[model samples]
Every structure is written in structure tokens, then in C-alpha cells.
Target chain A: MAVTGMQAELTLGPIPFHWSREEKRDFYARIADEAPVATVYLGEVICSKRAPFFETEIPETAERLERGGKRVVLSSLAEVMLTRERKATADLADMDGVEIEINNAAGLLARAGRPHRVGPFMNAYNEDAIAWLARGGATHVCLPAELPGEAIAVAARAAAALGVEVEYQVFGRAPLAVSARCYHARAHGRTKDNCQFVCEEDADGMPLATRDGRPFLRVNGIQTLSESYVCLVGEAGALAKAGVGHLRLMPQAVDMVGVARAFRDCLDGRKDPAEAEAELVGLCPGTRFSNGFYHGVAGYRKIAADAAAMADR
Target chain B: MTQAELVCPAGTPAALRTAVDAGADAVYCGFRNATNARNFPGLNFTPEELAEAVAYAHRGGAKVLLALNTYPPAGKTALWREAAETGARLGVDAFIVADMGVADHVARTHPGTRLHLSVQAAASSPEAIRYYCESFGVRRVVLPRILTIPEIRAIRKEIPCEIETFVFGNHGLMVEGRCSLTNYVTGQSTNMDGVCSPASDVEYVRSADGSMSSCLGGVTIDRFAPDEKAGYPTICKGRYLAPHRAEGYYAFEEPVSLNLARMLPELVAAGVHAFKIEGRQRSKSYVRSVVSAFRRAVDDIRAGVAPDLADLVALTEGQKETQGAFRTKKWR
Candidate 1:
């Protein structure tokens, strides 16, 4: 069995950076109203501390998304779980009707006694892990950002056979790592315990540089993301051919609605991928684009020929 | 009750020889490929060179573990598989693997070849370690450096594998083998590619007032005063701004050393089988000096002598060392 895009699906990936409660509420409200996404994921996927500010805002936000005709899925924290974190994950699992995206093994176990969607953070690289998740009641699984196209195809086939929807990150900076030490905390002369909500200052995260003055990475509290925007606009055909079922675009600070529309147009065959790529590239600030990870190359390498070939197809 | 083995890191063949000669019970090195986490230029052994190095170490009564720990890129299993096969053929002690796929491949193809789980696997709990042991026949696990002595003792009681703990060199609290923080900016991952903030991407620029800013791939990692020593330019170890603070500070960990030289007896008592020294990127002389010091310490501990840990200060990070997360959890 192989997956196919029977439904033109768009999943709003969890916000990778911290924002004010008002900002988060407004962001989701806009996504529910203006975006073309079919599903929206809410909750902190980066830092566990940032969850408190928005904890009360989630139910109303989930209701907003549901009212706007989008499916809402709450995400679990990604790394460095403590007892409190384990309890929070369990609480998320107990939420009725709101689908939970299991990001860590703890979350997987918490949501195991019931049906849920596995988030991108969990490593589902092989058939065995995928089958395990399937048996444990995972209805959908987002593939890891580092997986190339061939592996995606294999996993997509396997997920389809198991009757689970497969999703991939189509836009936004790919989440690279989750850490115990908050980079945001360290940057501000504080430890993770006293981070003082410093990460909220960088709406899109603080840009990190290599020693030689290269724009290398971004530090968003405990979460780290790739500097390059993982553009899959060019890989729509390969992904479609590979039987990918849905595209997940992470919410960025600016022009996100336009980014969503561009992806929507491209996925629906209403726009050329090259045109979509050009539009999406123009929308971002001070960032380059790459999809080399999909083709099994250095992630920053923008293979124009590959993009052009995918476009030609 | 054997003396805890001293496992050292060797980035080059010279370092390999230096480590073995300095009395390391085992030295771990990587092939000059993505198979190892330190895939920097001018480091790691070539396949031909690794065979010779392994033979030299084995003849010297020391073991060599080949690190083939990076995750295999999709449809590109051959490179990792080749590294595993080459390590086995060269009679290396073990294949240090982080990826489950590579571990499975090595275990299936080289049945008798020993397999040690890399810390990059981030198996911190007993259940996590037990999963590896039950599934892949993992003989040992280089545990992540975040656990305290009590936590280590607790996990040791439950897992089936021998626990190898880091005793010296650089320390990180981030989830090992799973961290892509380096890849977020530089397009290289220490886990997937075995390279983090690749040296080619690093640049140090002097600022006015005798201060300097270290950059990795064009982003400022940390700025330092002229009198202050510059640390390595990885993203997590950098200084940044936060509220309730006057200026940028080390957000993750400060430039510190992991010197468990003083805690050898405690670690051994906690059921650790091996003490690992973690600087594969250092000089051969550094390897010789560190391994020699730790070797005496371990031997003296085994012979019921109090280990002298004073000489280790000069080799530590920032000329300061801490027992790190090994002794206490509150260090955070």
C-alpha cells in the first residue's frame, strides 16, 4: 500500500519559538481565520517553561481553530523531561477530543493508552518504530526533518499500509535540536531555571553565527533550528510521487498567511513550484533556502538543478 | 573487580599511538567520514590508516573502538555499513553506534564484534539502556553526561550493559547524539553528520576596545574581552542576553572541564566499568598527557592508593575543572 494526496492537507506545525500569550492567541486566531491549513498544532514544542504563559490560552485557541474549520492538535514538549514535564504530558493526553502530537517517548507512552498523532520530534526512521507507533494508536506521524526523499517514500508506503496519515515539514526553519540548557537562558546570564522568559524577545529566535561570520543557526530558548528555511516547494512532485499525504508549515512571524497560500496553490497544482519558490523566497527576511536534506546532500546546498528538475517534472 | 578502564579519544593516528602508549586501556577514533561525530578536517583515520592503528593498539595491549555512531542518511546506508565492516575486519574492540539502524546492521553482520552504544544515543535511564541491550546486544553504553552519581548508580542497578562514563575533556548537558543545534545554523549536525560548527565555518573577529566576537557561520556566538580567553564557537556554549541580567552570559554551560580524576573511586563504586576522556580533536601530546595521568590515577585507585588529581588542572577547560553532573545534580 502507498499513500496518496487524496486530501489537500496542510498542518500548522507547533511554533518553534516563544511568544507572548497575546501574540500566540492572535497568531492562532489568524491561522484559524485566514490560513488555508486543514490542521493546526498548538502548544510549546520547544521549552517546557514557556508553556505556563499560554497554558490557559490553549483551550480557547483550540476552540477558535475548531470553529474556523481546522483540526487542532496539541503538541508535547520535545526534550529534557522532568517529573513535572511527564505530568504535563499526561495532562495533555487526558484532554478530550483535542488530538495530542507525541513529541517524546514519554509523550508517546502517555498518549499510548489512546489514539493520537506522533509529532516530528520522535525518531520514526524505520518500519519497526513506525509499526510500533501504529499499534500504539498513532493515527498520523510526521516524519523527521532530516529524512531524505527515498526514506520518506519508504515510510509513506509503510504508514499507508498501516492506515496512518504521513506528514512532512514543507516550510519554516527545520527544528534541529532540543537541549536541557536553554541557549536563551545562557545568553541572558541565567541558567535554565532562571531563564526569565528571555527567549520571548526573539520572535523568530536569535540568529547564531559561525566563528567566521556565517549565519549558521538560531537559538530559541531550549530549541535550536536550522538557519536555512527548509523549502519543499520544489520537492512537491517528488513528495507527491513518494505518496506524502500532508504538508506541515511551521508558523513564522511574518507573511505566514501568504506562505500558506503559496504552498496551498502549489500543492493544488494551481501554481508552478518555481513560481511558488520565488514567492516564498521573497517573503522571508535575511534567510537563504535549501532542500538538500530531502535529496541526501549537505542541508544548506541549494541544488538549483534538482529544484529545476523537480519543477520541470 | 577490575580497575576501571581508561577510554581515550584519538582524532589522528599519532594521537592513537600516543593514547595507547600513555596507558589507555582503550582508545576510540573515527574513520574520516560521517560515521564518527567529530568529522572535522585533518582529523579521523582513513580506512587503511585505521587498520594499522587498530593493529598497533592491539599489539600494545590496548583496545581500539571505532566510532561509527552518526545516523545514516536516507538511502545511504553503505557508508555506515562499510565503516562497521571495516572496524570488525581490523579487529577493533567495538563499534560505537548511536543510530539504531547502524547498530542493527553491525550486530547482524558482525556477530562477534562488540558494540558499545554512543552517548549520542542519549540513553540516560535504565529502561533506555535495557532497550538497547535486549535489542542489539549492546555490550556497553557511553552514558550521556547529564546524570548525577546517584542517578548513575540507580541506572546501573537495572541495565544489562556495562556503563562507561566520561571522566575528562569537554562536557555537554544537551541530549547527546540527538542534538542538531549545530545543524540549525551551519547546516552540519554533530549527530547526523558527525560535524558541529565545522572549523571551516568559524571566524574570530577583533572588536574595538580589545574585545573579540567569535562567530560560527556568520552569527555571533560569544563576545569576549581581550583578557578573557575565547572558548570554542559552538552555538549552545555561547553567551546571549536575558532579562534580569545586565549583559550577555553563557546560556548553556560555561567553558568548563569534566575532570572526574578526583571521583574515580566514587565512579567505580557506582558500577562504572570505563572512564572516557573526550577530546578527539586535541593534540597528540594532550592525549599522551591526559591518558598517562588518568592511567596512574586508575591504577593507584585499584591498588588502594589515593589518586592524585592535581596535574590535571593544566589540561582542563578554562584552566578550571568540575566534577560536573557526575557528582551532583545541583551543578545546573
Candidate 2:
């Protein structure tokens, strides 16, 4: 790969991990100043109860991100429909100067006849659903993390035909699911009502190991994520060829800006995807990277085969 | 009003017959695929078995609902579509689906076949329920276990579809159809792949303190003492360690059963159309006993008699049960 003008648009996905109000504000404030990401998704996507903590800071943070030259989008709760939660999401949809991302169909109902981005939580598996959302005023759609490349390519073509930007999770541990119950709290021996906000203790997420004692997953509050961070650095070429417009890197506890910059560098041809993977490893030590899901294999297969080769050596 | 419908889960034809004989109004089963949430191996029905089960249910005057509740994996959608077509051809009373794609497919391809939105769809709100009714013609929405009675009443007013609430069995606290924690650790999604913390990935190891730890996909989801009874290895109900807590505990949900038999009247009063009992993988004796008890309770309610809520206690998870979200938001 040679240096060129290619640019990998970075999207900051909604923070899946729960944090205190101050911690969340501080994270976004730092992201506003430092992250090379393009969009900042603000909302509590996991449990509806956590929304009250930082719901007030969302507008200010969206403004701050906008002020920092980043496009900011307020996201609807992925699992909406509770009375208070629905009202909260409705109020968020009513927020001004902020584009909204419809994580669930509730967003479509809330933002009826308004433009919004379709969040990855909504299943847009085929062109029909993608086109349906687009017709319903979706300008951008982040494809689900579980989608293989074939589906992505088809979705990209559909999105392009409808003049919508298609995004993929190019980094971070993929958010696998959101639940009404808090896994972390239950793990901590508490029910969701009395969870004591145990999720705040883990900055990134609590790493989960397989029965054989291998790291396989991470549980953060009600949301569960893959243990291995999905590194699409090696798939940049394939992504570009597939017409994916934006690469989303979920915000982690560490150097997200550097991670974004590395992806940017790789996309710009200043470094190889291999170089980007090396930097990603150095930036987030002890983390494993995999892109096997993109190639329609296991989610934990690393595209950079040399690391596995290195282990053999 | 007619006596409330007693919806039961049938893991096999024998269980279906057992439930029907025990006073089940309708029996629900799933084809052996990711389309249904109970994709447990050796469970569920094959095409021939499902055809046989449907015939048996109909002959016995019990309606059969085929579950195609899991989200269809991308690019492998034909499997779900085929399941839907086969279900319709077999003359199932309805198709219980969770995914929008699967629902859409069934609604369009088999217009005469009734569609019930699976709880796995997570359509918990009136607005969401309305969307399903309008878009895919969802006839009934199986309410997730996280709703209060008031929430159910509110939904009743907003949607045109009938509401089915879970009254017994596994009282899951998580949003249905959307959870992936099990798949993250076990390489299978409960909603899409229909397996959660699959047995192949589960391990039971004896700890140093004479306690046994239950592991899922090589990770300790929870542990129990030598005298303590361990629940099945599902990640959500597993105990984990946190910084503030010294002892590892239940990290997802308390190991409990959703035995809302006591709240039957309240749910029926709240415009609920049916009551569901959850355990399909259970033994036939368990099904016969639970179904008969609920049947008596429901009959008592119809006859204006206050039924005693004992005897069912033995079937409760950990010998304990709660009304769950039907009581209060604070009920844990």
C-alpha cells in the first residue's frame, strides 16, 4: 500500500459500557478534543435505567462534539417501550440541532417524518429493510456487527442506490446483545433494580473466559460483547471495494484517538493494514484482534495471520 | 368471557399429547433450526415430526403454534422462509415469529396463516406492538417478562392485537430476541442460533472450597456449594466477580422461575388474552402437573372461587417463585 488520498470516515458508536455521569462527560469531553472520529453517538443504549444519569449532559456533549467539528447524533434506546424510557426517548427525539439515530423501530415512530441514521441495533439484514428505513427518513445506516461481507456488500449497494452511507464496526469489541436484565449486576449478586451500578467498576468491560479458561467475551451491564476486539484494519481494502463509506470504532477506555488515527493512516495508504494492526496491538496491550467474521468464519479469527504464526514460532 | 387459553410448550409429540390431555388449549413447538429460540439439540421437531405433531394437536382439538422466533442469519434466510412455508402447509394454527424479516416473510407468503409475535421480538411497548400489528399483521404479542401489570394494561389500549403474557417457567429478566451474551461466550445466539450457553460449552468443575463452579464456554458463570443445587449453565443467570463485591454472585439475573399463577386474575383483568407456561424441554410429568394446576386455578377464577396457590411450589425454580414485574418495579 502506498500513500494516497483515501480517507476512512470514523464513527464513534454509542457507548455500550455504563459509566458515572462525570466519567461519561469526561470521556466525551476528551473525545471532542482528541478523537479523530467523525460522529459521536450519545445515549444509553443498554439499560434504560442508566439514561437518567447522563441524559442531561447529552445535549451539551453533542454541542461540544459539533463544536469540535464532529457530526453528533443522539441515539434512541435500542430497547425502548417502557413508559419512562419511551418518554425519555421521545424527549431525545425532540432535541434540537442534533441528528438522531434510530437504534430500534421506536426511533422511527418517534422521529416520524424526520431524518435520522438507523443504528446498528435495528436488523437491516437485507435490501428490503434497508430501503424501508431509508424511505422512512434514514440517511445513514450502521450495518449490524454480526453481518458477513456478502450481506454487507448487498446492503452497501442498496444503501448507495438510496443515497445512504453504510457503516461497519471496524474496531472495538462488537456489541453482541442488549438485555432488560443487567448481567454485570447479576454477576455481582444483585438484581437489576438493586444493581448498585456495578458496571461502573469496569472501565472497558469485564473480560469473560471460556470453560477451558480462554478469553471469549465481555459483559458490561445489560450488554454483552465479544472478547476479541474486531479489527477490520486488514479488511480496509475489501471494505472500500465493497463501498462501505464509514468505519465505526466503538469507544474503549484507552487511546481511541490513536486507534482512529491509525485506521485513518491505513485508509490513506500511509501504512499497511498490517502496520495498523501492529499499532492497534501496541495501543491496546493484551487485546486480541480478529476479522474472521468478515470472511464468513468464526468471529475470533485474526486476519493478520502472522500473530498466529508468531505464536507458533 | 371464555376461560383463559392455556398455552403450553411441547418439546416432543409425547409432550404435546401430554399437555393436550392435561387441559392445554394450545400447544406451541418449533422446527429444528435457528428460526426458533429453543434450538437445543434433540429437542424441537423435525418437519415430519412437526407435521405429525400438528395433526395430533388438531385431532385432539388443541391449536398448534409453530415457533420461528429467532432472527434469521444473514444470507441463510431461505431456511426460515422454508420453515414458514412448511408450517403453513402442515396447517399450523399460527406462526410465532420474532424477526421482522421472518414475520414479513410469513405475513406475505402465507396470508391466511395467523401470526403471533414471539416474546423474543421484544415488542414491549404499545407503539412497538402497534407497529407489528400494522406492518406484519401480528395477531398476538407474547409479552416479555419484564413488564408491570400497568404496562400491560397500557399496551392493551394502544394495540389491536391480543396480548399473551408468560405466567410460568423461566422468568428471564433480559430483553428477549436481542441478547447475545450466550453466543458471545458459547458461539451461539439464543435468538438467532437458538442456543444459549449450549451444553457443549458448559463445564462443571469442583473448586478447592468443596464448592462446584459452573462454567459456560470455559468461563465461570457461577458457582455453588457442595450442598447447593446448581442451575443449568446459562451465562445470564451466572455469578461473576466484581471489584466492590468480594464473593462472586449472580451477575445477570437471579435464578428464579416466573410462576405468576397468583397474578392470573390481574393479568386477565388487564386485558391479557392468554397465559403461557414456559418450559418445553421439561419432562412430561412436569408439564402434566403444572398444566393441571394452572388449569384448576384458571377454572377456579372462572367459577369465582379463590384458588389455593400451593402444590405448584414444588415446581418453582429453587423452590421459590415471584410474581416478577407483574407486582412492582422493585420486585427483584
**Can you list each candidate's DockQ?**
0.26, 0.37
lDDT of 2 by residue, B164-263 (tens): 9999988775677666566555556575588777887878899787888788766677778899997787766766554443455554557777788778
How well does candidate 2 score on lDDT at residue B281?
86
Error of 1 at B302 (Å): 2.8
Residue B205, candidate 2: Cα error in Å is 3.8
Taking all chains together, each candidate's TM-score versus the true structure is 0.82, 0.89
Candidate 2 lDDT, A1-313, residue by residue in tens: 1112275477888888787888878888888998778888888887788888888887788888888999887878887766777787677766666788877765566676578888888876666567667767888888777776777887787688889888889899987767766667766567777988877888788876543345666888767787788888877666766778788889888788799889888888889877888899999898888776665545666645554334323
Docking class of 1: acceptable
Q: After superposition, how far is residue A262 of candidate 1 from its true place, in Å?
A: 2.9
lDDT of 1 by residue, B148-262 (tens): 8887887788778899999888877577766666664466667667888788889888987788988776678888889988877877678765443335556567767788877
Top candidate on TM-score is: 2
Q: How displaced is residue B14 in candidate 2, in Å? A: 1.8
Chain A alone, model 2, TM-score?
Answer: 0.92
Error of 2 at A248 (Å): 0.9
Residue A253, model 2: lDDT of 80
Q: Rate the local accuracy (lDDT) of all candidates.
A: 0.78, 0.78
